[model samples]
Target: MPNDKNNKTELPRNPELTPPCGPVKGQYRKGISSYKGIPYAMPPLRERRFKAPEPMPPWEYLRDCLKPGHTALQMGGILVDSPGTYQMEGKSEDCLFLNVWTPATNPEERYPVYVFIHGGAFATGSGTEMMYDGTRMAQEGVVVVTINYRLGALGFLATHGLYEEAGTTGNYGLLDQIQALRWVQENIEAFGGDPEQVTLGGESAGAFSVTGLMLSPLAKGLFHQAIVESGSIFSIASFAPHNRGDLEKSMTNGQLLCETFGTRDTTEDLYKLRRIPGDVLAAVSMVKSDQSVTPKAFCFWPVYDGVVLPKDPVKALAQAEINPVKLLLGYNTNESSLFIKGHTNLGIYKMLCIEIFGPEKATAVMEHFPVDDDHTPLERMLEIYTHSAFVVGMVMMAKKYASLGEDVFFYNFDYDPAILKIVGLNTAHAMELPFIFGNGIGQHRATKISNLSWIMQSSWVNFIKTGNPNFKEEYKGQVLWPKFDPEKKDIMVFDTHLSNKALPYQEDLAFLEKIMFGNEESV
Candidate 1:
């Protein structure tokens, strides 16, 4: 990992700039000022475990905000430096830092700010993922902020011991995000950002966290707009430890985890869980996050603790109880293919439905996921998981927000190149990230691919700048994206030609809804 401890290394200095909180120096370029690893909260270790985040202690001396600090202790996933990808391991509990990319440092030029949360199934991922680079977005005239929050059991393990001590139970991770937003409101102006007009967004697990935040009363005034890419509690609930939250089950899981390490006493185990080395706890939590299905899949995720999240996220959004922020959400066409790496049979498919949708609805669910003669068994399996996990839930939320008269923009990303389709990840989960951030500047080898990415990138930043994603002038040959209407359900389909179409795959989604009863499993 890089030395991101606010080290006072001899580098090009931009003079000491003092803010309301502290004095920190950052590297300034011709048009932008960059700051990395700025602590927004004290590390969540030792006595701080399972508690709400505390403000970063103020410093008197000049602190160097240069490199990104340690990532919150996490098991490797697609977002981390993993074995299949890179080899860097950034795991630490002292990971409550936020990185800033700004166009100006002057307080007068208040720019629209976009704060991004990363996704890793709620157990992994770091904001420093190469694909989440904010330079291009900042250059497009919006201040960009990326944050890190605690993951795994450290973030979501709710228990009676915790409820008695802290009025709140689990959701320390969500609190970490709220605290970071508070820090932004307090300090972003010093870094050339308008805290008042912040837009919150993320992909997959980050998007799921965004869902939780939008529905959280504590996060009410912190953000003005939201952009959720490919996550929905209505769909993700299947992975939760319990659908409605069973304290007995939670206690049992905790007890077993303790017993695995030869600790039988519940009190002793709870204390040990808090006192053990950060990495050791993270390693244990990583192992537990997965179920019998796979090693990387997560079974432990966010829960509706009634305090942190008032109701199940699906119900909260459905009833218009969530924060009335400007909403933009969408899903990919082949989202499930990202998870379905191998072939499977009808028996396995039926078995998964029984586990996910329950036996009462499993047989009925198969009607929605029919195996057409033209499609392969693997394609059928991908469709079942994809539409169930992403498409239907996302569409339902957009309709809910639109019905409540909230400003909503919805889309369907099917802009898959031949290469992506050949690799079997055509418009798969998180595939739109590069296009949205325009992080593909150097990797592009073809004009068509470059042009598509440019349009997607401009649309995203434009939305951040004004809450409207339509950018026809700068990115020529791009179609206009209209506001989503529940009656018409005008969906923006992003392909070679960006066009508007009525909501697609409605019949299939309706069937899923009939059997699933609206996120019965998005745990």
Candidate 2:
């Protein structure tokens, strides 16, 4: 156990600890000891670029983990200025670092672990982002971990030559995530974390990663629980221009990228691509257009690489071939508001709908969210995207988990702060993040935001600790969050007052289910 002596003089100012990987020095702050910028995998540069991450070799010296490390190479301005904004500085290809925040570093003290993955559409964002600081969550009695994985073409380019060399191509970012989890499994105990009690959680693309990891055989037994916020395999299936997990499209994109880099898809060219500067590769891989608006938005996304991701996640989930874990997942009410911006008339909205769902089904889907006096074209478009990209997908995942007799809890985050309301992005995508991390809210509405944050953090911690959100004594009088039932579709609505209710868009989701899943009774 950590020394309970609260006096500043009683604690070591700079603590040195030894984990399996190496001895590391960390700083003590507020009641938590943070070990930042711990390298979990070898630098993915030069010969290692576009390859599976190699475990970082143990060091004989005491490594300095006091400062933040480099983030995966990515283009700037990819993140929005919402609560979800992340720092994009100190970018590099040698970015396989993870940070840990723990109340104590006593190996005997086993606290539940919460490993967070950042969301950036799989192209941007970093674990070192200020918004992802794990101090507050660590204060709540659990060890918190955040990680960095390679992004964009540097992490996901797939090609025939690359496959011949590595036996698989693409999904390298996913492989990076898996490597991070393996590190947690091997070393979290030194940070006073119970590796067996680790809960993998994320929002948006991170949530997409949680689902991806759940589907990957390589990630099995890495995490015992999952908290998927605002995404699923269904989100990727609904949003990606090509089919979800389409390796062929990824390979074609890789060939195009090679051509863009003035090289052919040869073994020698693979070596040449690795030698190119990281910044130049990141700039070349940037997705210039808005993914939500552009139907053919070409981006460096994960592929169904036969090794890392053996098959399409949606198909794997449908076949009940997923890692069995207690699930707590949901989406915000206005998840699409962040992505769908600028001049969007009814014509563009209709075209986008037709592009996503075929012309035959587009008309039917439009009828569900019609533009009238109360609803503008933009409002309708955002609503359609919110449901299609986030809500329906989460609900489908919840139902599938429930069918498998897994402990699944579903939620709908509708707590809209006044600050966001003034900007017309109420309860937008990643709005729940501030509450979850207990940071980023302005002081004007501090009390209300703090109250919601308390509820979110407490519930999340409880779930991580016991696999049940309603396990705490304070939640006894409140509406008991019930397990999601496929028939009833029970949803825990997080708003001014917490309530257990039926899902909001039942009929719409059923229609979408039919459209997306071809009227199959089984999801």
Candidate 3:
């Protein structure tokens, strides 16, 4: 609304907005007003640990929302420099906070809202990451929100004890996310955002969370649109054998974790486990592994508890029992590049392949990606993972949605900026974040990176605004992004020279889909 000529009047330097919970004061900066560190749920501590989030109590006084709040207790440096370096301070179990950015805080104005979930393999990362700052995106006349949910063991640990206590278990982090969206639906109007026009999005684990939320009955009408970048329902299958709906494995792992603390899976032991320090719980749940290879062991993740996620993702998609939302989803060319590194010999590659796909299917799958003089075994393994973990599942989901007559847009991000190419990260996983957020592009003005950033930001904002990326007139003739056709499978390729074309690696994707989904018709 700040962009509208009729509403161009100067706003107060310090803005105050009253929502259902309380009155919060936010600061104005360069025409954009932001509220940071607003708690959407009560702190999950002591007896509340590992339980479903409860709504924060209403406050009578104006709360200071100037600085970012504590991130969910997590090991630092999972995606950055070192432990405690990314988020130096303010890491606590009491981290159910969210941040908002808006062009104006006038309750009369109704702008589209985008609530993004940060991803760090469901363990690390926070809403306040520098790359996730919403100021630039807020300039596009949209309200932007980012949030921090519980992570690692503090967020997801399923056991019989937890099941007895909460009637379900293992998705406390996801419950935190759902609570945040509820807060948006209840309070976004005060921040000049339309609760009915909310778009939920995320990357990596966050993307997984978005897809999980789509299948979750509890999260069903909270959002109407979704933007999933570089992750999907099948992404977690690479690490763990059970589907997201399966709780047996997660419960077994939870018991094992409790055993590590010299405790049992009884209700009494649950209290003892909760009494452990947050940092100690985070540290004990940490698993050290080589970044080059896909981890074979199980880690804490969302489970099909028949409550939050009522059905297995594959079954849910097959039954079409998901929240039907306009979807804009895609993946980068080399999604596995960030996770896989170092030289992979043929023996190691074969072993990894056998580990992922069974020995019976490994040889057949290996035939599709042969190591050659130009394509080393490492490159072949990376390609195998990129398709198995990211591409196949994403295409399956997109095709499923398109088949159901949902407005679906798909993309392939192939833009490899020279700076990243030099380091062998050519359009790797999460490389598109800075561009989508309109950050980290000032230094690359001389190249097409800035222009590509503009294209992405414009398309993303248009999608958030109208549920159609091509709704804007400027994209009418020059860049016509077409809707994904289930039969044709057209995808918008994001690069220096953008084009709409059929998805690449079709044969490979089909093969992987068969291996992953078998004879399952619905995917």
Candidate 1, 100-214: lDDT as tens digits: 8877644566788999999887677778777887887776778889999988778766655666666656678889999989988988887668888899998888887887888
Task: Report the lDDT tens digits of candidate 2 across residue range 337-413.
Answer: 77776577888888778877767888988887788899988888887888787877777778888989999999999
Per-residue CA lDDT of model 3 for 328-364, tens digit only, reads: 9999998877766666788878877876787898999
Clashes of each: 8, 0, 1
Q: State TM-scores per candidate.
A: 0.89, 0.93, 0.94
Flag the better candidate by lDDT, 2 or 3. 3
lDDT of each: 0.73, 0.81, 0.83
Report the C-alpha displacement of residue 430, candidate 3, in angstroms.
Answer: 0.4
List pairs with backbone clashes in candidate 1.
119-206, 236-522, 237-521, 237-522, 237-523, 238-521, 238-522, 238-523
Question: Candidate 3 — which residues are off by over 4 angstroms?
Answer: 1-7, 76-78, 81-88, 241-245, 287-290, 293-298, 372-374, 443-447, 475-477, 519-523
lDDT of 3 at 385: 83
After superposition on all C-alphas, the RMSD of every candidate to the true structure, in Å, is 5.3, 3.0, 2.3
Task: Name model 2 segments beyond 4 Å from true.
Answer: 1-10, 81-89, 287-292, 295-297, 358-364, 367-375, 441-446, 475-477
